[model samples]
Target: MDVQEKCRSWTADHLRDSGDCYYQAVTRTSGGTEVEFRGTWVIMAASHDYLGLSADPRVREAAVAAVRRFGTSLGGSRAACGSLDLHEELEGRLARFLGHEAAAVLPSGFQANLMLAPLLADGSYVFSDSSNHASLNEVIRLGDAKERTFLHGDLTHLEELLASVGEDSGKLILTDGIFSVDGDLCNLPDMMKLADSCGAHVVVDSSHDLGVLGPNGAGASDHFGLRPLLVTSALSKSLASVGGVIAGPADIIYYLRFHARTSLFTAAASPANVAAALAALDILQSEPERRVRVLDLAEQLHNGLRALGYDTGSSVTPIVPVLIRGRERCLRMWRELCRAGVFTTPMTYPAVRAGREVLRVTLTAAHTDEQLMRVLDAFEAVGRNEAEHPR
Candidate 1:
């Protein structure tokens, strides 16, 4: 069959057996947050706006001024006619912010990984962490490098894999600085030591860790004092924008600027996005206390959950996972929480192992103590109800 027919068949099959999924599209008003689905005001605890900079007046003004000056679209790839002053400014600012020699901007974090992996060609081996994000997995699959999976947070496994690679082969060790699902940090110091011993270059994806971890939010590397060969992150998360960046040696960034398919073929980030990211970076740099607040909120939530007898997996950061035994219970709990005006994402199946379904609670600096208490109360009520119902 043709492409349209095949897509229809696949969609039919998938939807036929799909379970109910809940989502709320929120509309912001001057007074409070409103949910389009429920048509009522609701508190938000689901967004990744870690520092609440997304709606900051200064950030919004910067974005607006950029749009007014440069218009909305780049209309071509960066290498062609899309390269603009804003793009260069953002890249330069990001490189300086992260203390990297240079940086290249990509359309998204997924594309950043996808492009970076393939840059390491033949005679190379990619030693990847087991708990890395799916984008990194896709990057490895597309690359020609021989792949080895090391157990998550296990430096011993990583060392063994590095040793297995051929002596002359160039090795790249890739890991998430902060795991997305569990919010646990990678053992960067140990990983760096192992990579150094094996003469392997390290690339860390600090998608979740940036703007929340590290001193002044420089990310996990700054937090641990282990300088990697490269670092990549998304502006969509903590920066509250719509692009990705790869920061490393100046020569490597120049190579990717010219050759990385994602950057060469895709249109440059809009001026507004670049401006917002720049403003966010300035805010992050100026207000070091925001990072501290995020850590404090994470500690408070983790402690509260543990005290209430919830099984929070080994998380020490803003991402907290409350383990639910089964998929059905997980979905039910999620629905119950939503019904009670608590918004959260349910992670299961391919995102995690089948039996490891969880309610992923992300904390942000914008959230107040009262809001967190409400979230804790909602969890307690849901857990109690689930226990009583046994389904």
Candidate 2:
């Protein structure tokens, strides 16, 4: 079949099994641990609210107060005088929280990667991880710089590729702090040491790890005590806010503020959203127990699921993927689990390897022991159900 026909056929096939799959919105929320899907309240094991700050009363109040004061949107780009005090405050707090010299908040994490490409790609050769998110993938493909892809988390492949390029050539390496699909960390300490040996610079997308990793929830870099040249993260995930930020040297951030076209021209982030992120930072600083709690939940689930005979891959983070290995099997499990009132994401081909599909379960700090038990029971029941009813 032609490309369009193939895509249409794929969509048709996906729709046949996906009941309330993609594009289904939550009608109600409770404690940030459960969401209403298809008019049924289901435990949210697929959400990214790691610290549960998204539903915190303090965060809600802060966002509400900002809306009352600033009236919803900023309505223009930061460069067009749409910038608010909250923007500056969040940037400062993120820089301090992540131990960076400076930081600039962008409209979204996708745009943050785009902004960095122009600044860093001008004189560099990009060496990217094969499993890096689509944002970083697009940057490498579209930027002016030449690029190469190393095997996912394979330092040997990276070293070989780096050796092929000139030592004097400016090098930019991009990777995820915690890979969303596999939930494995990047080995930043080793990566940084290798980069140093070759005089290359590294940039990390800490969207999944920031506020959920490290000594004080400082992210992967802090977890390893290595400072990359630049680091980026999305506030929407852990911070329960809507925006992204890049923390790096003051000079680079200054250049991006003036030159990054997306951040320069796109409407500034909403004041309330920025305030919510600020409150999230406060919680990260004060309630370190929240971080511990979430990690403990992740470990419990990871261990429990493995003990029950499901393959969890190599996850060490809140993002755990239960590898069911077939599209039909994965979807059937997802459908059964949802019916059992446990919602999870079934990741099939294109999101994961063709034969390594998974049911992605993302745990949050707000998830209670009772809820966790319920989810585990539901999974066991669903897996048994899947085996009884074949595709």
Candidate 3:
């Protein structure tokens, strides 16, 4: 069948099922841990707002002020007149925050990853994690560099790949600091050792790790007290804003600013987003407790689920995946949780492997202990019913 036929088949199957839980229209939100879906208030457990500052008064005010002063978009790419003082300021602060010499702001995290292609010299060897984010894979493909994949977190496999490459060829090791699907952290310390031995430059896509990892929330690289050659991330997650950043050495950032086609071609991030990102960064630095609380909440939820006989894969980060055996079962569980007033994400085929289906549960700093208990209780009730019915 053609692509359209395949699409129609999937839609028909999903639309006919009571378990279809995709594309929930969130009509309202408390801007924190609760959201109103179809006029019902549900505890949000699928959000990426790790710091829970997306709706913070400070961030909102900063965004509103920017809209008033700048009146929405800059109307062009950064290469033109789109560059704003807010963008420059945010980049400066982010560079210091990430322990980088300099940083470049992009319209999105996807675009930040796109900067990779422009940096790759010819004959570059890209060693990527099998489970790296799609954006990283896209960047490598765009660069048209020779690519090698290693099993996720399998340093021995990576070592073999690195050893096979000639010493003279440029080597780039690309991996996500936190695997978005399974919520497992990359073996950064061991990976770095391998890279160092092979004289390969490491690039960490830290979209899920920034503002959620490290001693100062600088990400996994910071947590390990190691500096990769470059780091890229989205501000939309923990920073609680919209935009992306590429942080690295000043000279390299300068090169990407002028050479990276993605940044130069796409419209610059809106003034409000940049302003809100700045405000969020301030909050992130001042309130380190958000990081602590969010991780604690994640651990609580993970342990709570495991205690109830659910398999939460190896995740110490805010993103937790509750492993389920089948796609239909995962969707049914998600629907049950939604009915119980706890909103979560269901990951099935295409998003995850067939047997690796899961209910992707995430937590934010704003989530309370009471809310967490409600979530666990909801899961417990759902699991009990499923056991009795065997659906």
Candidate 4:
């Protein structure tokens, strides 16, 4: 079938059956731990707000103050007139926090990843992790470079791909610190060694790990005591704000700021978002306990679910993937969870391979032990029902 016809048919069938799992409107939120999802108050496990600072008073105040001072937007791209003091300030703080010489902020994480496309000069080679986020994949597709994809976290496969390429070719290895769908970490220590052996630069998309990993929330690279050639991340995650950052050496950041069409053409991030991110950064640093608390909670949940006979699939991070195997089965599980007063996300085709669907449940520092117990109870109830029905 043609694209339009296929879309029409799929939308009608999918929405009719499982659309509530896709976009249930959240009318209100309390920190990032709970939300009024579709008029029902539920414990939130579907958010990327790992630090639970989105509803923090300080972050809210910072954003509100910026709006009052800057009047919503600067109204142009940073290449022109949209640049603000807040943008430069946030960039500087991010670079210092990430142990980089410099950083550049973008409107979103997708655009931040796209910023790498312009850096792929002729004869450049890119070795990418197969499970990297779609934005990273798109960057490879947009650039005029030879591409080699290695199986997720498979160092041997990565080594083979790197060996096949000419040593002198300008090479950049792209990977996600935490695979979004699978919730497994990249083998950065081994991968970095491989890249160094081949004289290839490495770039890590640490969108999901920043502020939730490492000694000081600098992300996976920091956790491994190594730094990539560059690190790209979304402030929308652990930072509890809206924007993206690319952190690296001063020269490379300067080059991307000037030449990256994605950043040059798009409007700069709003002052409010920049301010909110700055506030979040402060919280991430000052309140390191949030990281510890959230991680502890994640481990608790992961173990609980496993003990209950769920397939969690190699996850070692706050982002947990409960493999449900079938699309309709996954949707039904999501619906059942919601009914039990727990909010979660369901993943199906395109997000994951067909029939290997899952529930993408995330944990935040604000989540309480009682709430966690409730989540496990909900899962147990749902699992019991599934066993009885045998779907």
Candidate 5:
């Protein structure tokens, strides 16, 4: 078949079988409180700006200064010409922030995983959590490494899998420090203990945990007092900037800097992103109360949803999913919430499994108690209406 015909056929089949798999874009203002699409303002509850620093004035100032000094792009890969003083500074600050011996910054978190997976190489087996973020799964596929998946957050299953793998094999146990969809934390201390017993290295993707978990926002490892062999995180979520970082032993950082193809091919993070992340790190280090406030808000929001008769499913982080049973019902709820001035995303099918559609709500530190109460009120109203109408 011709390329156009093949593309058309695939599209037709996909639309016929999965017509409900679509997303709507709602333009957001700089403040992040107001979202406008098709000329209507809506309150945003779907963002990953956990610390609410995306539009913070200090962060903006840092970005602006960096842009003036360095322009917009890094222009080349780190191996070539992209490395800058800001890059080294950010890496150093992040390493210190996470209590790691060294850290390396990449263009994105996806690349960090893509690089690390293959760097571990042929004899290694990857033990990944079933509920890990898609990027890690993609890394496992691209690396062409032997992999086993344990049940989501089931430490017993993880231990069993680790026990089955031989001790001589280099095993890398990979999991999200905080599972993105459910906002539930991994049982890190237990997982670390199991890995230690089995002689496996632990790699945690703390994209959702950094700037939100642990004392002083050191992340899940610190929260549980169990250090992993390595930690990877995205700056986009909590740090409210762009770029990714991998933190571990100095040797691992050195190896990835030289051998990881993704790092070798892609341009390093831009100066502005580097600067903004550095500023965010400074804020996180000096004022740890921000982390406490964000966690407190998350707890309050989760409790509020539960009190209103929503099934939030064991979430202990900033992300809370309200189970809505059917795809249509979930979308309807999302639309209703949006119209009622609270914007959230409807997650269904591949993002989750079939029969587990939900309205995913992410809480941020910027949201006030009044705003949270308003969100709860909207959910309560929708819940009552949906119950009465049975749709």
Candidate 6:
């Protein structure tokens, strides 16, 4: 067979055993924090709805209003007639929220990285974290810059690499502010210090931390009290929308606006997504309690998992991973959790390690304390039962 067919054939047996659940769809949410999956109410632990603003009535109304006014498509790219008033407003609001001089809203956070990295990569040596998101890695490879990847969150190693490079023209350090899989926060302040010492630029992809970090949800930079060279985030997560933002100096945004091919070629975000993002920002600002609740519940979940002898490696955020190691055991636990009316996703091989597979669970503000307890109970019961079989 062809390459596509060959790949499919290679993984068909493995996928058939446990990967099918990923394709299953939820008809609707049974509760704000639970979904109706396969005719059962499964508590949601696999989504990025940290603040639960995606289902907020105000966010929904804002989206509806935009749709009513703008229809659907916005014609051409931002460089063309696709540039709308909503886009500019959203960009400005995001900049102010992040305490940045300016911002450029993109179609998606992925596209933002794909475009921005190339612009900054010219005449530069790149220092990237090994565990950063795929988008950052893609942009680095696409660019002409020479790149070095240090161990995840290893600033000493990063500094060593930077020191060896000896001040390149466009020295850039790329990292995810909040790692998606493990939910570990990168030390941006220390990274900034290293960048400063080495005369390098820092890029913080805070896609997973925006609208859920900082004292006021300003983002990871604000949380660390340091202003990096560049900050980027996806609106889809806590922003409850479907776009991305690149916040930094206005001059940089101006440069990217003119040079970033992705922005120049791709159309602007839909009016509904823009409006929803704006609404989500408002909700995030007005309701700081949501962030508190999410973190609290996450801590509780983390603790419970640990007490049950599940190895959750270095996570302090809402995303909790129960490192189950073996693929078979991981799939078995996932299946058991699903059967027990708990919805979760398993992270394996490419996402993590083959021998360090995990059941990745994310908590949101929408999850009630009672629901959290029930989820823990499910794990407790399932673990107890699975121990006897050990399959």
Best candidate according to TM-score: 4
Residue pairs with backbone overlap in model 6: none
- Give me the runs in candidate 6 sitting further than 4 Å from their true place: 120-122
Per-model CA lDDT versus the true structure: 0.82, 0.88, 0.90, 0.91, 0.85, 0.86
Report the C-alpha lDDT of model 4 over 224-314, residue by residue, as the tens digit: 9998999999889988888899999999999998889999999989989999999999999999999999899899999999999998999
Q: Which ten-residue region of model 3 has the weakest summed lDDT?
A: 16-25
Off by over 4 Å in 3: 1-19
Q: Write the per-residue lDDT of candidate 5 for residues 1-391, one digit (tens) a residue.
A: 9999999998997676544435566666747656796478866788888888887899999999999999999789999999999999989988888889999999888887777855557877898899999999988887756889999888898888888877798888889999988888898888888888888888999999998888768789888877798899999988889889999999989988888888898988999999998888888778777788888988898999999989999898889988999877887787778767788878887899989988889867788888888899999988888889994
Better of 3 and 5 by TM-score: 3
* Residues 246-287 of candidate 2: C-alpha lDDT, one tens digit per residue: 999999999888977878889998888899999989998899
Residue runs of model 4 more than 4 Å from their true location after superposition: 1-6
Model 6 scores what on Cα lDDT?
A: 0.86
Q: Please give the lDDT score at residue 252 for candidate 1.
A: 89
Judge candidate 5 at residue 90 and give its lDDT: 89
lDDT of 4 at 373: 96
**How high is the lDDT of residue 280 in model 5?**
83
lDDT of 3 by residue, 163-227 (tens): 99899899999999988988999988888888898999899999999999999999999989999
lDDT of 1 by residue, 182-258 (tens): 88999888778877778888899999989988776889998987779899998987887888999999998898887
Clashes (N, CA, C under 3 Å) per candidate: 0, 0, 0, 0, 0, 0
Q: What TM-score does structure 1 among the candidates reach? A: 0.94
- The residue pairs found clashing in candidate 2 are none
Question: lDDT, candidate 5, residue 54?
Answer: 82
Candidate 4 lDDT score at position 66 = 96
Candidate 5 local accuracy as lDDT?
A: 0.85
For each candidate in turn, the TM-score is: 0.94, 0.96, 0.96, 0.97, 0.94, 0.96
